[model samples]
Target: MGTRWTISTPEPLPADAVDAVDAEIDRIDRAWSRFRDDSMVADMARQAGRYPIADTDQPLVDWYRRLYDLTGGAVSPLVGQTLADAGYDAIYTLRASARVPVAPAWDAVIGEHAGALELREPALLDVGAAGKGFAVDRVAEIVGDSFDDFVVDAGGDMVISPRSRGLRVALEHPSDATKAIGVVSVAGGAICASASNRRVWADWHHIVDPRTASPAREVLATWVIAPSAMEADGLATALFFTPAAFLRGDFDHHREGFHHVTIRRNGSVEHTAIPGLELFL
Candidate 1:
């Protein structure tokens, strides 16, 4: 939620429209942000009880479930306390705490429920992985009719206007933030990047494998392009633990259309051959 988001439009957005968009962003943060107060997710975390599930928050719960299955629980929306244990909690002005919080069981945090969405455990949920991408997608949907060509970028997750000519996108180096590992031209759909080094504090970064309750080893970053930003965002996180090939299903034929670039810790890179897109190193 600390990331900066930008909405680029070919035409100027009306002042009221801009305010409306900002309000929507704030609303999303309030619903999903565990670090902040009065958020529906945060409220659930505090009380650990049943509450009426907000319709807007349903997508997050749904996506988390899909991602949990996709990555075999490697990426989840319910790793808040694990992150806090690794010193990724609020009050960042102070040094990171060494105490490790237990990573909630995926079943405990997001088990099947017939009626409504509820947190049944002492859960601290952080949706940073794919949430921003979802937000980008939502904003794109909200503004689709207003603009002919535009890009909505939140951190590295981007939703670009559909075009025949691909948009040149620079893939940033995970270890060295200033450098580019590769560049790709995106033809259509949304692109999201997940890296291990961006939010380093006390020698620890943001990404933590829910299984080990520790930082994921190897693989600097992953980029995924999908028809939907939410899917792209979730897949980007999924690619962190598993290889790009695993994301393909029987229905996908050979390619998942999920072009991924995995930058190793040693500075080497491996990327899938995406259809209609070329990578330049």
Candidate 2:
């Protein structure tokens, strides 16, 4: 929630539209920000118990549900409370806390309810994984008619549309922030990257495996490029914690397109299984 977000355009906006767009971004920041005092998320969490059935914010909740099945429940809506217990509260800022050993699939602070869109157990769903991506996607949707060459980056998740030159995206090294292992060219659509090193705390970070209840320390980072930012966002989160054995080589075939990169803890790049994906490197 304290992450920095940047939006860029290759072309200048109309004088009249600049102020409007800037204002929209601020509005979005307030609505989407968890740190805001009157944030919609806070109200929702408070009112969840009284609702007919607990549910997440629209479009995102729908998207999360879809990806949950696709990733075999590796990603879930019931991870919010458990994540907080792991030192990731509403704020991303880290604080010193005693380390609690998580037994396999042990979540200490969650309750069962039918509020989740997906009928899952002990779920504490948090949309942090996809919230930034969705915010960028919303910006893209709002400005889609205005420009073809534009990019929206919330934290590290991004969506690009090329009106002229193609998008050149760099893959940040998982271990070294200033280093980049490879650069991927994106012509149109979305790209999402999840790193274990980022948003991490003292032996505890943002990434949480719902089934495992323990912080996943295997892979360092995973980058996903897909047709929609939502899909890319969800998959990046899922694959970031997904065991290597479950993934099909470097990439798995999707009904749409397949292009991705995974960086191991040791800093080696794995190209997607698709034949031409090597070109992204």
Candidate 3:
């Protein structure tokens, strides 16, 4: 949601076409924003411990639950508590700080759902990954009926249709914003790049690993391709919490329509089993 929007219509769009797409995007923003007061997700978070039986929120809850399991609790909504402890208590300050915050307990804490989320716990439900990708997916659904080809860039995450020659995306250097570490092509589905540099506040950013309750080390960025924007979204965030040693194993296990390219702190690159993965550059 922090990213901008760029539309490549197969043909020059009528002025109304732009307005319509913008309206649809705005609608998506209202429904899925984590910070917007009117957003459905915000409402659910506000109700947290109050909703025991997941209904509409079930998909997200179920997805988060799985991540909680798969990563041994490396990714979580409960990371809110960790953020507060590290001084990222509010949105305004977090936006201002632009720092990668390490979870105070990452080395020791296990992120398994201790129990159903409880309001009493000093935890926060930060849906940084889920929010934007989900919004992009929703936008695609809304626009699919009208436009056959389009790309939605929600921060660094994206989803595109094969309507274009091929979707060319740039991966920003983790330490340097102006330079692109590399570029990748996405077509027919979704691709996302999650990095430590996108948003930092006081040396702290929103991506938090529930395990050990801190920031993930070693990998600077992970570029992933998946069947859905949502999957790519979660996987990219998951990469932040995972170790490079485990990269191959994870790819082999879940590798399907997915491909990945990762940049290390030293500026070297490693890729998953994605075919012609180097073609994008």
Candidate 4:
């Protein structure tokens, strides 16, 4: 959510259309942003109680629940406190705490009951893994209502609407932003990427492994393509901890609806054989 975004269409969007998109972004930030003290998630962190869940956020909550179980707790919204302790906090302090605490399991801390999120204990919920992608999809839907085709790029995570010709996207090298490792043709759907290179401070990065309360170091970068940006974004981060095969086998839709590529610490590349993706090295 702390990044720039661009909306591409054949023609310039109407002023009202642009405004509508901006309004939606602000709405989502207020609801889910951990960086903002006034955000709903921040309020949830302050006290343990049954908080109302907006209908718009139902998909996000559902996705978080699914991802948490799919990856066996590797991906969690409960890591907000861990990230803050590790120096990625609300004020962007980038200063690690004396001791960071391991994230609590999802079931141990939070639950959903009667259209409300019940928190057993106060905890910071971070949805950076997939919130952006979900936002992209929502923005795309708004854009789609006015235009037949469009591409919504929220930083590197994107949602491409159906187009006459697909767009060719370059996969940036995790270590060197100036070099591209490969390219992929995206006709429609979502493509989301996650890497350990960005947001660094004193031996820590943003992508923390909840299991250890530490940054994930095994995989340098991961990319995923799915029917929705939310799925792609969540899966991109999950791939850091779970293997592609397990994800594909565990979820029936994932077997056919998802494709991924991962760059490991050993400088080796591992990926699913998909027609649109091409790697140079």
Candidate 5:
């Protein structure tokens, strides 16, 4: 939510198209942004209570629940407290605490009841793993309603409308932003990527493993393509801790129609054999 975004269409859109998209993004930020004190998520951190869940936010909550189970709890929205303790707080404090708090299991701390979200205890919630992608999908929907074809790019997590030509997306090297390891032609749907090198401070990155309450170091980068940006974004983070085979086989990612590539710490690459993706390494 802190990054830039771009919307591209074949021709000039209506004058209010940008305004509509901007309004939707602002609404999403107000509802879920952990960096803002006035956000609904921030209110949850301040106190434990049954907070109303907007109908638009239900998809995000449902996706979080799905990813929580898909990754076996490796990806969680409940990692906000740990992230803040590790120096990624509302004020952008990059200094890690002497003792970072452990993230509680999702079921142990939160529940959904009668259209409301009830937190058993006060805990900061971070939905960065997939929130951006969800926003991208929403934006795409707004744009699609006006134009049949469009491209919505949110800090590189994108949703491209179906086109015969497709869109060529470069997979940036984990260690060097100037270098690219491969390219994929995204014909349609969404493609989301996560890299450890993007954010770093005091031996920590944004991607934290909730199980260990520490930064995930095994995989340097991950890329996923799915029917929706939300799925792709959530799965990209899930790939950091879970293997592709298990994700595809056990979690039925294969049936769901997605492909992924992961760069490990040793400079080795692990990926699925799928069309459209080509790796130089």
Candidate 6:
């Protein structure tokens, strides 16, 4: 919630509804912010052993599990301490420090227990991969069915509900936000873009690979469209590390479809069509 959010609808949001929206965002921030002391996640990470998992943590955990499998650990929530070690700490300070954080074996720690779920490891549980997209989805609930059409843009990650026409979004350069690489059209769903362009400090960026404990260097940015913002957000991050072949595997493209656009570090774009896969000119 450190970023700004913009809501655009056919009509302006009512005063009370705006207040409700703000409150909901604040609630989510308090639950998951590792930078805030009052946050349950911060407290659990600070304690770093055993703590009761909140109901809210379930969504985050479930998504992380799915993403970890999908990307083969390329998108990992257990890299929280790794991020901190790299200078992205509690206060958002960036440093040149590089240290491999202790992996308490998330498998050994997180699972079904007697009455409550617990994280036995010192895992910090970084949900940056899908948190923004998930939040976008959740915030749309505030707007409800009040408006015929609306769009929520949380720092460029978005959820658009269109009554008639689809929305077109420009894809920005990973290193330079001002320059755009291409534009994409989405009718009624979520679009999530994960970039190494920002949230960087020293010699490192925010995106990290849990397997090697380093930043993913192949793709600079990735955009994904899915049925839900949470899925789009999660898969977009995974797209940074996922190969194009995976999306076009055995799955049918029409009935159940996924589209990906990946921007490489060398200023080239690779696009996986909803029904095909190819690189752009």
TM-scores, each model vs. reference: 0.90, 0.75, 0.73, 0.96, 0.96, 0.88
Write the number of the candidate with greater TM-score, choosing between 1 and 2. 1
Candidate 2: segments with Cα more than 4 A from true spot:
15-33, 50-57, 91-125, 163-165, 243-255, 266-268, 273-281
Regions of model 4 farther than 4 Å from truth? 254-256
lDDT of each structure? 0.75, 0.63, 0.61, 0.90, 0.89, 0.74
Predictions ranked by TM-score, top down?
4, 5, 1, 6, 2, 3
Q: Is candidate 2 or candidate 3 better by TM-score?
A: 2
Ranking by lDDT: 4, 5, 1, 6, 2, 3
* Winning candidate number (lDDT): 4
In candidate 5 the C-alpha lDDT for residue 21 amounts to: 90
Worst 10 residues of 2 by lDDT: 101-110
Instruction: Encode model 4's per-residue lDDT on 109-182: one tens digit a residue.
Output: 98773478899999999999999999999999889988988899999899998776778999999999999999
- What would the per-residue lDDT of candidate 6 be over residues 96-168, giving only the tens digit for each residue? 4545664344576566522344666545767788888878888887876567588989988888885465676
- Relative to the true structure, candidate 4 reaches a TM of 0.96
lDDT of 1 by residue, 72-127 (tens): 78888778877877777765532455566547668866545334656667577788
Residue 54, candidate 5: alpha-carbon lDDT:
81
Query: Positional deviation of 56 in candidate 6, in angstroms?
Result: 6.1
Find the candidate with the highest TM-score and give its number: 4
lDDT of 3 by residue, 1-281 (tens): 45776555567666665677677667656654555567654655455343242333446555666655567767776675566555555454453233434433322332332333334322335666665666677666656656787666666677788644566677776777887766666666888778877556555565666555455566778877887777677777887766544643544544464677777777567776664344323
- Range of the 10 consecutive residues with the lowest summed lDDT in candidate 6: 272-281
**Per-residue error (Å), model 6, residue 200:** 2.0
Decide which is better by TM-score, 1 or 3: 1
Q: Give the Å error, residue 23, model 2.
A: 5.4
